[model samples]
Target chain A: MISAKLKERLIFIGPLIVLPGLIVAWPVLEVLWLSFRNRVQIFHIDRWVGAANYLYLFGEDLRFASAVSNTLYFTFVSVGLEFLLGLGFALYLRFSPEREWVKGMMLIPWVIPSVVSARLWQWMLHAEAGIVNYLLQSVGLTDAPIPWLSSPDLALHAAIFADVWKTTPLMVLLLYAGLLGIPENLLRAARVDRTPPFRMLFCILIPQLRPAIATAVVLRLLDAFRVFDVIYVMTGGGPANSTETLSLYAYRTYFQSLQFGYGSSVVVVQVMILAGLTAVAYRLLQGKNPAAAGDGPGEFHPRRTEVKE
Target chain B: MVPVKRKPIFRVETMARILIRSLAVLAILAGCARSGPLPDENKTVHYYQFSLPRDREAFDRLRTWFHEEHPEVNLQIHTLPTSSDDQHQFYLTHLGSRSLSRIDVFALDVIWLAEFARAGFLMPLDDLFPEREWEEFFPAPVQAATYDRHRYAAPLFVDAGVLYSRKDLLLKHGFAHPPKTWEELVKASRVILEREEDPSLNGFVWQGKQYEGLVCNLIEFLPSRNPFLTVAESPRLEVDRVRRALGFMRDLVVRFGVSPPSVFSMSEEESRQVFQNGRAVFMRNWPYAWRLAQQEGSPVKDRVWLSPLPAFAGDASGGKGALGGFLLGIHPESPAREEARAWVRFLASPRAQRVLWQDLGLTPARRTVFPDLPSRGIPLDVLRQVMESAVPRPASPLYIPISQSVQAYGSGALAGVYPIDRAIRHIESDMGRIMRVMH
Candidate 1:
């Protein structure tokens, strides 16, 4: 007969062994393993050259640098604008008389598929026969039509505009949830005490909504970091690679260049950066408590003591 | 009891039993997956053919014929999109995976054999074609199929960018014939565009899209001096000659304004629609447009005429017109390779060509088919001349990227995003970089 201790250990380790195996852990490990190798061909795989792929990406390849810069630029600008607009909409909706119907209609942009939106935007912005150009020219704003997607300078900005339209609704919903729980009595008390509109909001409202704002920012930030499909189908990282992002760069290396090893390296770098940012965000959201480290109040003050007494 | 209490001590016997059973299961799975080279009667040959809207019926009829002729050999045909670049991407992805199965016959561009063959995706057909039968094919068509002294593909169908015109419009202008040179064609097109009642109506509708179709329409002027970059021995372009040729084409849209901004959005169907509705005085397209123009309710019905694209002026020698055609290849992974070979041979034969020509209105690859059959309404001399004169694009692996870059630069210039000289220099620089990597 097996010992009880051994049986317990076996049961404990069984899930630990199989859980990660089934959840794409093995494939990820394989990519990490291959990332170290150089010049993998159809049948033969070359041996390890530590950090060569990493060096190539960071040092030699201007494309990768451009992609990183563009990705960061897009993420911050778009998310920043989205947050401001979303917060404003949420505030307006909080005070507005027609709250339910107005809020329901506001979700329309968020519900539409991104690909469909991109295609619609492409048609509206076509240089020759597009509606935007026709209107622009008709009103005597400009003599000629603007090459919105064709201009390298404006391609990324145009893509950002399309993305912001789609994602702003998400921000609105998050901020709206935060706004709903702002303790209306405290706000009334402050207003009765002659706390001006700006002062009352800054002092009483925003502090209570900190947790919700943090959550929304984290969600938007993470999503913005991995932007691919919209920019891909729209500009294809073209007009002289002005709008190239890390995801597109990785894809080109993997598919177009057929350099899986180098592509894996790029993916690993992105994962690490995202993971680091997420960890920091999570810490900030949980209030960064030192006393709570390996100890919640429940750990210190047990309910069993009351039972014993 | 004490002995029994002592654990099995990591016994090899039990461990061996578990290992053996697992191995047995794995072996069974492996065996099941292999299927051991399909049974002779069940072995099927699959071919990758491009899917164009116009060829759906023809492909179906061809499949039915192949099945009847070789009942034992099951033939599966897969259709890809008409865009050559898209189709090339599919092939590239599959080939990179080293999974050559599911394709017995690979339909490729006439210019892609050299690169594909070198890449080991194509099977050479040196011993497949007999010496005497090779002579029957038009020289240009045969030359297109041959790369580096090896036959990797067979020219299946021949297409040329013929000028499809409105015969009634020409007659009204007191010109019963199509223009013979670039200058004459320009004058005729100008007159039609200027006099047309509708402002939206165009005099010429040629492909100016940022894709392979651009090369098909624009490269006709390349033969003003020598279109092919390399001669028999050399491997470098006569750069100045090519530039001059490209200049003539650029001037057509930019300088003349004969074509429209809408041309940038057009493909084969778009161009065909423009001419078929009498909105265009002339359209440059493949032979399939002939059948479409004759269909009922077509505005240019019974008033359509086809001729080779006009040559450049001041040229005693012929102008360079692009040779457009498809090539059939056999996949190395095909189970029924032998039967697929027979099918390809039969399809390439004059008998099949005649049937394709008569039923599908497709031009045959063989020169003799045009003269040998009375039912082929095309004049024998004209067919021979087009066959002899057609200049196939450079058959390199880099052809797709190079051609795409060509379209990108040319379209950019036509759209007024860049000047002609700047665009040409950009193209030359970009192509030079790609070529260095290729070499």
Candidate 2:
């Protein structure tokens, strides 16, 4: 004999839970499992070699170190630039009274596909026949056309600049949302006090958006850390492996070299690094939220719903 | 009360039986799915290939010709990306999974034949293609598709690297013909470049990117300096010879300023676009470009001329090229192997080769198809000479990584990222590590 309640639960909710497990959980678990085995090729049954793949990459490969450094450098710089530019633009939007159209207009680059933006940037930055070079030479800023993509020193910067262009718009919208959430009463009080504009900006606006800033920074950092398409399209990680990231490294190691075990180890390392960084970001900003009244200590509690009676 | 109790029990019994039957049916379906799809009765054979204009047209004609010959068998041609590396990577993952029904025949790059065979992706075709049929095509191409005395692929069309020059430009500069030697080429290009004085124009253009093309370009430079350098087992390149050759290429850009700095970023198509746009005096490309260069509305349509890549100044027998071609291999795990074999046999026939040549301008693998090459085309004499003199890239199963290392360091040296000496040492070390780990 079956209980009606248990049967109904199994018939309906069981599928809803099991379907996601089959699709998402299975692949995630497979990757974790594959990271331990020494599967050099795709089909061959490989022996379990616990942490050898990880040890080989971290210990033996110099390229791995360079890749990690490059990834971190690229991520930090790209995110930092996006944050500064995005906040500045968002502030500009806030200061202006009628700029509803500006938000939509600025999203052109963000809306265009990453690959398209990369190709467009590449063409515009070409050594010859590029409008950028033409302008540089015409203005007497440079005697000759710059080899933007060809120069090992300049290629990474070019890629970063292109990335900043493509992603800054998204950051602007996020910060704008944060800026809009600032209570009108708070600003009115600052105005009533005749607070200096710069002082109000530094003390009020900056302190108020700490939660948004942290969230934005962490999200942007994670996105920037795994950037593969822009650099791939722009420079292909070359001139001399100047712009290869961990993701690109793992991809090549996995697909091109057929060393799946090593590649998975690289991916696992990357995931751990991102997680550690995210934790650090959360901890540093954990106590800065003045709006929360002992609700929690280590949570990113936005003050959106907080009220003063 | 007793009758009511019996009825309820019977109802429960019926429900239990129904559930048991449903579970058994579901189990049967799951097992069938696990074992993979049953072989189809209509016998559709899938041919995996890459798309180029000539290849597309050639296959279209062959598809019709093929159906006329074998009415009972069905064919499905699937196109992959044109990049050889991409196609190989696709198969590496696809065939590695051992898909049962998707692909039957694979038109693979000649270089990939060894890797595929070694990895057990391809079936041994010794019985399918007999000795007499194997003896029909050129020996070098056949040798390329064989590993461990087992023939794995049937040679399709062939390609070889050639030097394409602006004949009109060379003639205008008082050179009656194309340069016969690398030294002569440099001297002539310098004279013409100085006279032309166009900032956009470069004297020479070639594929200098960090990829397979670099190996092709570099191999042509090697034999002139060290004639014994071959892509055979235990291959060795003389250090000084490599330096001289790479230095010569670097000098064209860094020393003489005849080739552009942009050449470092250019691939085959980019260089071709430059040459065909009348911005470059010379180009190095394959036979496919010869056909493309002559297409309508091309800037250098009537002015382009072809020849073997130049040798060292005095070595008469030193001009060599990279032997390039495509071949078809049957998937070992394919269910429709017999139908696929029949398709391969038809394609290997000389009649198909003739149709391919006539329609698409593809160079045939068999020597017999050449005598009847259509007259209204770019002269085949130069292509024949180049093909005869062409050499193959290293015939190793680990060729992908080997070529990647070469491309990376070779382009680095060419782009002045490292001096030639340091670049060679780096290449040697990296290649050694890669080979040691992989093999």
Instruction: Give lDDT per model, in order.
Output: 0.72, 0.79
lDDT of 2 by residue, B329-356 (tens): 9987777788999998888789987776
- iRMSD of prediction 1: 13.6
lDDT tens string, model 1, B1-439?
0112446777899899999999999999999997876645436767787875556677677778877887777776788887676786688767656554456777787877766776777788877788777777767667777777888878787876677777888888877798878788889888877776667577788776655777776667664635535523324444676566556665776678777656654668868877887778888887677767887787787897777778877777665457877778876656677888988887887877877777766578877677676544444465556667777777665565456556656666665656656666666654553353332
Best by TM-score: 2
Clashing pairs in 2: none
After best superposition, candidate 1 residue B198: deviation in angstroms?
Answer: 6.0
TM-score of chain A of each: 0.84, 0.86
Compute DockQ for each candidate against the true complex.
Answer: 0.08, 0.20
- Top candidate on DockQ is 2
Candidate 1, residue A242: the lDDT equals 63
Cα deviation of A5 in candidate 2 (Å)?
22
lDDT of 2 by residue, A1-309 (tens): 779999998999999989999998888778888888767574354668787666766765655776798889899889999999999999988777556568778899999999999999999998876789999999999987898987777888899999999999989988888887777667778888999999998888877787788788888988998999998888777766667788887887777867677678888889889889888877776557756744244433344432332
